[model samples]
Target: MTEYILLAIIMVFIYFVLIRNKPAPKTDWEGLPTLPEYKEIEKTTTSEGELCCQYCGHTETIERSLNSEKENPNKNKFYHACTNCKVILWRSEQS
Candidate 1:
């Protein structure tokens, strides 16, 4: 009976040592909708300062917004986004 108890204690100790401190599995943020992508911005705005959105046809100089690339996260990759339709109008990348 004492040997059985010792074996049981050893087994429990091994279980805790092996299972308790295992590193968590890595996660890939591929399917997250909130995550942005580094791609082309279609239906971009005018370069002549027309203040127009080509996709939704929303025109307003004040409502235009500017944003950066998600992957780069720098001022080098700048783009204009429409406040009304939330679409990227124009993109400028500093070479």
Candidate 2:
């Protein structure tokens, strides 16, 4: 019984250390509403802004345009992922 308990404990520790997930996988995609097509704003209220993660609720300010003109010319949408959660946030309309 003592050996079995020790083995169990070791197994649990290994599972947590090696197999445990440090960060949860991204599930926002296909769940949250997709961001609308980006539109270049001749005049935008907030040029530099931040996007808070829906899962962790962590806010990250990005200097890049809210809407990326390079990727989606017709629709200017900034594509970025959360450093912590690695989840894709929304691309505002240069706001």
Candidate 3:
């Protein structure tokens, strides 16, 4: 009787451990919506001008980098992010 009870308990423990330790399947990509294509702005320099998203026409705030000016004296570098569509417009020294 003791042996049978011990065997049953061990079997139940093993079953629970195996089933609970199984990893969840990857299915997040199936339900995700596709993102729209990124749009590139024609103009580079903001120069304290208002930035707007080309696709949604949402207004954006311009962020200027002083570090870029220190590195390259001739060129300017800045980024503008749209409030509504969250699009980023940037101008690098190379552009």
Top candidate when judged by TM-score against the true structure? 1
Stretches of model 2 off by over 4 angstroms after superposition: 1-51, 61-71
Q: Which pairs clash in the backbone of model 2?
A: 68-77
The 10 consecutive residues of candidate 2 with the worst lDDT sum are: 37-46
Q: Cα miss at 59, model 1 (Å)? A: 2.3
Report residue 45 deviation for candidate 2 (angstroms): 20
Q: Which stretches in model 1 have alpha-carbon errors above 4 Å?
A: 1-49, 61-74
Computed on alpha carbons, the lDDT of every model, listed in order, comes to: 0.51, 0.51, 0.50
**What tens-digit string does per-residue lDDT give for candidate 3 at 63-89?**
444354444465454444556776554
Off by over 4 Å in 3: 28-95
Residues forming the 10-long window of minimal summed lDDT in candidate 3 = 29-38
RMSD of 2: 12.8
Model 1 error, position 5 (Å) = 62
In candidate 2, position 64 carries an lDDT of 35
lDDT-based ranking: 1, 2, 3
